[model samples]
Structures are given as structure tokens and as C-alpha cells.
Target: MKYFTIFASRNDTNDMEAVIREVYTGKHSIEKTGHDYTVTRKSLFNRWRIMLRVLSEDTNLDYFESNIPGMMGFYDHIPFADEHRKKLVLTQISALNTMIAIEAEKELGDEPFRLCKELLSKIGGIGFLQDGTLLDYDGQVIVYPDGSSGPADFHPRACTRKIRGEEIESEEGERRRQASIHELRERGIPYLDTLPQLPPVSECRWKSQEEIARRAVALLIVIQYACDAANGGELDESKAFVMGLLSKYGVEDQLTEDERRLLSEEQPDPQEAVNIAWQYEAYWPLIWALQLTDSLDFPDRICDSSYAIEAVSKWGSFEELYRQTALRSREDILDAADKTYRLHWACVNSRIQGQDAPAGMIESIVMERRRGLFWMVGCGMEDWDHIPMDT
Candidate 1:
């Protein structure tokens, strides 16, 4: 459950170093030798450290979160400023746990996946119900196991019509109910299990899908600006840029011509980029929680994006930004990304689980960001030599 900041070298060399800075914990000594920097800490569960290890070995993964603990439990007991804040945190935890469960099912083998689901269910986090419906701890269904609610009723009339070579089909409503029932039986849920599963998590169907997509796209846009600024106000040929980003989300090949055209034509100013990044404050924490950069495609995006270039180019350097603005603007962007990510999960979880999304969740997230309470850059690069070699 420990938290740390990763400061990577901003140069283009095979010997780039990453400084792992531990925070909110006991002091640790920092040791530097050649290209490797280490902060000796007692904790064994260093997420970034493990991620780097995995990346260096180039292991194949079915899903990014499969091996990573959901980490939502860390926030469950932490006190927030208000009820709204507390709700926001809880909702985010639920959404994250749900996502983890989905990944487990998709990636793990039968025994391991079953155990994972059972463990989550026992912990009251999120997992599939006995009826194969996805749900959070509160018994709100998020995804239907059979992809439908129930089966259709048997109709004597339909049988007669078919026997006479006439087409007779069950009503859509009846078919849906029957399909749901059949799925419930297959998943071993009680035949009478009537727990309502509301808005489905089917792709492109959820009401908040558009909002999440918009925010995600905005994030890439801001990142593009940051990359450009770092590369002397020009796109970097070596860096992945927009196409690289689109690929991470598995949407690169699916982009319509119009979307591609817009991305190519749009030339947003630095201020506009910052403003767009700020607009999605609620999602930032979720992004941080999910450790989006840990995904296989993400490191390349970060490395290629050259966010540090912009940090240095616009603010003179990371050190200057850190000293003068307390890294306020950069921190703000990270915070927004995390919160917006959480808000999205909350909305998705609510829709699937048949629960109302927390009221004013987005507004509360934005307000918290404005208050400047949680300010920390989740990840970034810096000049290796500039980092202090002492705790």
C-alpha cells in the first residue's frame, strides 16, 4: 500500500535512470551507481518497481491488471473531508475492483480465475454473483454472465406454426427473459434470483461511455500538446505521438477518417491543452490508481511522448517548475486524470450494478482538485543528475 513517485531521466540514451522516490514513510537512503538509482525501502510491494521488472523482461500479458492487486482497499478506511468525498472514493474502489474481476475472468485459467472471483466475493469487493452476474460488494449487478437476462417461454402456438411451415417467433421481451433465466441456471444461481441488473456494460451502450471517451480523448490531446512543447513546438518523429497513443486503447485501427482528420488538423495552444486536461479532474485519480502507464503500451507512450521535453521547454526545466509552481500545474493535470478516471468507473459501476451513481460526483471531484488537497505527480521524467542522491 506504499506510495512513491518515479522520476526518470529525460535524455535519449541507453543508460537512462529512474529514481524511485518513496513518500509518506520512514526515511530511506538513496544510492546511485552509473545508470541505476535505488531508494532502499523495507516494503516489498513496490508497484512501479515490479512494473519495471516486468517490462524489462518483455513478458506477454492477457490483461494489464491481472497480476496487480486492485489496491482499492487502501482507500476504504481513509477518512475523507466529507460524505461526498467518501462516496467518491468508495465508488472508485468498487469500479476498480469490478475491472479487476473482469480481467481475472478473461486472463486467468479456470482454477485461478475461480479462486480470484471467490476471493473477491469473500472480501466483498466485486465479482460475479452466483448467477454469473457481475456485481460490486453492494449486490449491484454490473455485467450479466450469459450476456442476457433470461430465456423465452415455451409457446404451443409457435410449435404449431412451425409444424405448419409458418414462421412464428417468441416476442423479444419473452426471449430476453428466457435468455436471462437460462444464463442464471448455467451460472448456478438460485432459479428465483431476482437481483436486478440495470444498465449493461456492453461496449458503446452505457450512458457514460461518451463522457469517458471524451475525457480519454482529451487526455491524449493534452498529452500531444505536452509532447509537442517538449520537442521544440514540433512533433517528434522518434516519439509515437497520437498514433502510438491510439494503439494503447486498442482503437488505433478503428479510428474513422473524420477522427483522424481532426487530430491531424487540430493545433491546440498550450493554455487550451492545459484547460482541457483540467476539465477532467475526476478521472485523474482513477488513472493513477489503475496505473495506466504500467500497461505494456503505456511506457512506450510515456517515453515517446517526451512530456519532460515540454516541462523543460516551457518551464525552463523540471527543477524550475518544481521550485516555483511547486509542480502545481503538472500535479493538477495528474490529479484531474486520476479523478476523471475514477468518475468514469463510478458511472460504469453504477450503471451495471443497478445503483444510482453518487450525486454530484463529478462536481465534487472538481471541487477537491480546486482545493488543491491531493497534489502529486504520479509519474514523470527528469534529468538523472538533477535528482538528489540522498534521502
Candidate 2:
């Protein structure tokens, strides 16, 4: 029951039904309303020419998030260019990637091709709603509604024309593209001429640094109280502080599953205690996000619990801690989000391909960092659990 739309040109004069019958190999029905033709293909992405001709329009893709399989030769389509935009020279269609997969990228050497979007939940962290799968025949990603890190393919109902479909799908063009990368690498850089403008911040009000500081403080309070309960420390004093935070910010709901259990019960299972320790991994990212710390280091190991505890402990009150906070600029936060997004893709890909994580990245570190970044960039989303972290 996967439903999506194909955006075809109004100028396309071919009989819509005939076109579908010619290009689509599967048994499906097309309900031609006005300009739109709704077709059900028993399968998706089976042929080269069929794939190209299916898309005579792509402007409708704006309703969905777009990902590039590789660098699109924007210069190849000068008519689609805008001199005022950074995209004019060449804009890299970024898919989820890490350290720029220089070798894997050779498979998708720069060539003029169309882009498409999935009409799925646009809210998931990079791959939360989308699985990274490649087309069996072509090795291009199958863009679904939820999301797709489409490095090199399109659906019959997806794709757009940056140039004639024939040239791009031609044997000569494919051969040229294979050789193009090595020559470009040998002579000059094959990197983005310009970065596309990232999606703007959502209209939802962004949480102030003060609010996040309070959140961090509240979470720590609960964790500390849980520790005392576990270690047979004075519950009375610790409960007072934890209750105070709950009374104000109520970040208790933000705790991990085990941490939430700790709120009710005094004792933590041995397994729970290990998870609670990893809460520092979660806590460290928040402090880093708030600029309370500089960089969040590599994820191969645990973050310093002492430094994490001290971060909130040094400030006498929640208000005092927030007052000292200077959140990073939107650009800085987005950069981190972009970095995590790509690295996360790498981490997921490694597991799928049975290889080591790129750049020694651990799943936990990337997950924690992604959780923090997703929250920060998500504009108005306040609930920690509500934040999506699939990438």
C-alpha cells in the first residue's frame, strides 16, 4: 500500500494511458483524473528507459525531502541555473555519507541525472523512517515515502529531468561517467562547488538555551537521586533536590527506560546501573550542545561522568547555569547535525555490509550525539522521547 505521485509535465502531449502502458511492465491500473495519472506498478524500477521516461516533471518533489546519490552536474543544466545562488556553479546533492566515501562514490560518478523524494514522514532522523536499500539491478537507492538516501536511482513515479533522459541513460554516457571521476580526481578536486541551503528552522519556537540548561539540570537531578537510592545514601536530601527539579522542569519524563524506572524504585538492577552510567553519554551531548563544553569527542568510548556531573553541579541553581549558557549559532548546530547525519549513515551501512564503523564511530556515541542534535535542530520539539534518532 505504498502510495506516491508522479509529477509529469503539463506540456507532455502523449496519451497518458499509452505512455504508462509503454514504459510500465507490471500489471497495474491508471486512473487519469486531470493532468495527474495514478498508476499501480506491481513492481518498481525494472528498466533503464522506462525509469527515465516516467519522469517528465519533478517540480512536485518540493513537497518531499530530496537526496542526491552523488554530485549532480548542475553545470550541465545551465538553463536550470540561477546566478544569485550558490547552486549555480555546482551544488552537491548530499545523501547520508561519512568522510566522503571516495571509493564507493566512484560508482556514482558525476553525471546529469534526476532527483526524487519520498512522501514519508519527513520528521525522522536521517533514516528513522527509511531503510538504506539499493536497487538490485542498478545499485541505485529506491526512494520511498518515508525517506531514502538515494545515491543513484529513481522510481517510475519519481525522478526529474535535468537533461534529456536518453543522454543520461545511454551506454556511452554511463561509460563516460565511469571514467570521468578518475580523470577529475587526477587533475582537480571532485567536491561540491557549493553547498545547498539547508532546510530552514521550523516555525516552531526553538527552545532557549535557558530551557535546555534547565532540562540538563533536571535530568542530572533525577540521575543523582537515583544513584543515592542505589548506593544507600541519604534519600531525604537527594529527593528534595530531585523533587525541586521535577516541580519546575519535570525532565524525569525524558529519562531512558531504566532511568525512568529508577524514579519509582530505589534499587537499580545491575544491568540498569550500566545503562544509567551511559546516561552520561546522553548528558555529555546536551552540555556540549549548550556550549557548556567545547567538542563532543569520538564515540569509541564513554564520556567523562565527572565532567558531566561537574557541568551542572558547578552552578548553584538552574537559573544560574542557564545564565552562563551561550548556545552555538544555528549554522554551527546545523553543521553538527549534518556531520552526525552523514556519519550515522556510515554506521548503519557498516552494519549492513558487515564492515567496521567508519572512523571508529560507535553506535552508542553516534546515537547519543544524534539524539542531542536532533533535539537542538528540531526547533520546537520539547519532549526528549518524542525526538527521533534512527539515523
Candidate 3:
């Protein structure tokens, strides 16, 4: 059997699926099945809205049993189905921001791979075959760097999450770190059980010291540019620098919702501009990881922006930064990752109970910092753009 494969780095699956339909159905108006519901992609002018019907997954998989091939790693990891019939499956949707790598197979020809190549071209995505070939969006082989790779390698991006609800007061008034997990046991997150465990350092891959150094600088540039756009800096779409940054570093897919909107709108949202400015919190830890700074400041307040900027900008070039770079161990990064993960739960619990964040633990600070740490630890191999802050 021949196989077809496609990989996409998209902020969310909504746009990717719509574009996929455009390629699949020749731009004709049609309804189809998607991850969560049936979707109709056509916009019929002058038509009234109507109710929708969705599909049911009533079909059995390989005699009524199938493992979600998504996170479980390899097919060779667990043998399934008949020792006779050939089996091929691909699953998972970027209902959230995600890096999606998919493969399809046909008993005869390579049409599926051809179609997948088309999809890849349209989405500006990349691909990796089981045999270790990395393909560009146009389905041509790319020069693979020697020996260093991971989720960060394929999807080299920095990310941020949107904070909803009324703003919670953040301060350094309380001088204690967050209480232990047992103390907050009563404040269980409903979705807590559903989140993925942090994969061990030995089991996961990592970005190189130089690449991490370059990307840390890239994150600062992206945050600065995006904050500028959101605060009425420049709204025109013709500027090629923004496009270059967004595409090259996968930055567009990693934007906050309001930051994403600022790219299209003629006017900018002032509040979100301030919000994005505070996103310096996300960049600081990378500086720490690169050994630019010593230790992270306590997360009870905002990151020192002046220091973060000076620390990163002081480097004359990527090589200059790489020369001074030293990424900490994955174990070290994961330790902080786990700590922040729990602190995020505390912040959520405080908001849920209508109380201030415990011990003055700043919600946004904890979140942005975790975004950095989680990205460093590969966030359970999650795409950087939409790494969940789920506790």
C-alpha cells in the first residue's frame, strides 16, 4: 500500500478545514463532516439561516476496537486488528491551536499523497515522513539540520493565551509562593483529568541552544511588532515584514485572538495593546533559559520589561546571542513547568471562588511564564501556538 501524508501548523482547525474544503470540493458550495459538527462552508447571499444536523460515528473500527493513533506514538507500539487486513488511520483536529501531522493510505496509487501535497501547499505547512524526510509546503525535500529536533524544530514558534472575564487585581503584596497541591485539593478543575501528562525529558526531544537563542530573539521581535499593530501602529496589510515574520516563525498562528484581529482591522483595540505589551512576561523566561539572566523574578507581578528588552536586544546578532546561549536541562525546565501548571490552577480556583489569587499569585504572569516553560518542555508535544493552560 502507498500512503499520503500532510502536516499543518495552524492556530486553529477552523480556517484550515475551510481551506481544505476549498481544495477538496473545487470551491463548490457543499456541507461536510468536521471534527465536532457538520459544517457548511458556502455563504449564500440573501439566504436565511437554518437549523443543522450532525453526523454520528456509528461505524465500528477494526472489529469494534481502535486506539486513537494521535498521542500513543507508533502503530508498532501496539499491534491491533486482524493479522490479515491492512490498517491505516489518522486522527486529531486542531479545534484549538495545534500542529497537525496526518497520513492517509490507499491500497493502490499515491493519489492520497498527491491530494495531501495540494493541501500542504495551500496551508503553507510542512511534513515529515515515517522514514525521516522533511518536506516543504510545496512537497519538496528541505535541508534537515544535523541531529537536533523536536516539536519546536518543526513548529518553531512562541505562544500566548487569551485571558477572559474581568481583570483580576495583580500585586506583590503577599510575599508567599502558592500553597501546596493538597491545600488546593477542594478547588479541582473540572477538566483537570482530561489534560495530557507532561512527557518525560528522556522521552521527548528539544530545540538546539542556537535555535532556542534565535527563537527567543524572534519572540521578542514578534511581541514588539504585534503590540505595535494592536495599538494603532500600522494596520495596512501590504507590509511584507509582518508577513515574513508570521510565516517564517509560524508567528501568525501563535497570536492571541485580539492580536490576530489587529492584523485585519483598520482600527486597533487599546486594551488588547496593553495586554500584548505585558506579554513581555512570555519572553523573559526564554532569556533565562538562554542564560541571559539568572533566575525568573517572582510571578506576583509583571515581568520587568526594561530588563527583558535590554537583555535580548543587547545581542548584536543571532550568532552573538547564540555564542552566549546555554539552554537549561529539560528536567529543570519541566520542574518549573510543573510548578507553574499548579499555580495556574490556583489562579483559576481563586477566580472561580470570587477570591483574589492565592498569595498574590498573578494569573497572567503565571500563564505567560508557563507558556514559555511549556514551550521549552514541548508541552506534551503540543504545538506552541495553542498550548493549553489547563491545570
Model 1 — TM-score against the truth?
A: 0.20
Point out where model 2 deviates above 4 Å: 1-198, 202-205, 225-259, 266-276, 379-382
lDDT of candidate model 2 versus the reference:
0.46
**Each candidate's TM vs. the true structure?**
0.20, 0.46, 0.46
lDDT of 3 at 10: 43
The better candidate by lDDT, 1 or 2, is 2
lDDT of 1 by residue, 1-391 (tens): 1211111111122222221222212534445554334434345652122111111101222221221112232233344334443343333322221122122212244443333434334334443333434344433443344433222221111111112112212243234334555643454332221111111112112112222333334344444544454344654442346565454444454443433433454453555344333423423322332233221111101122343223223443223333332212332333343333333344333433455544433433333232221222221122111211100
Q: Given candidate 2, what's the lDDT at residue 134? A: 23
The worst-scoring run of ten residues by lDDT in candidate 3 lies at 85-94
lDDT of 1: 0.31
lDDT of all predictions: 0.31, 0.46, 0.51
Candidate 2's TM-score: 0.46
lDDT of 3 by residue, 1-391 (tens): 2333444434444465566566656323434454322222243642211111211112212211122222212322233332111011111111112333442222323544565577677866555565544466677654223322222222222122211111211221011112223333544421121122344455445656655666576667656666676556654543356657556544344454555664556565676556556668877878888778899866888777778878866766556656777878766666666567766755665565567877767888988888878777674556545555544
**Candidate 2 residue lDDT tens string, 220-301:** 7676775666576776777677777666644555555545676656555645554454456666767887888898776777
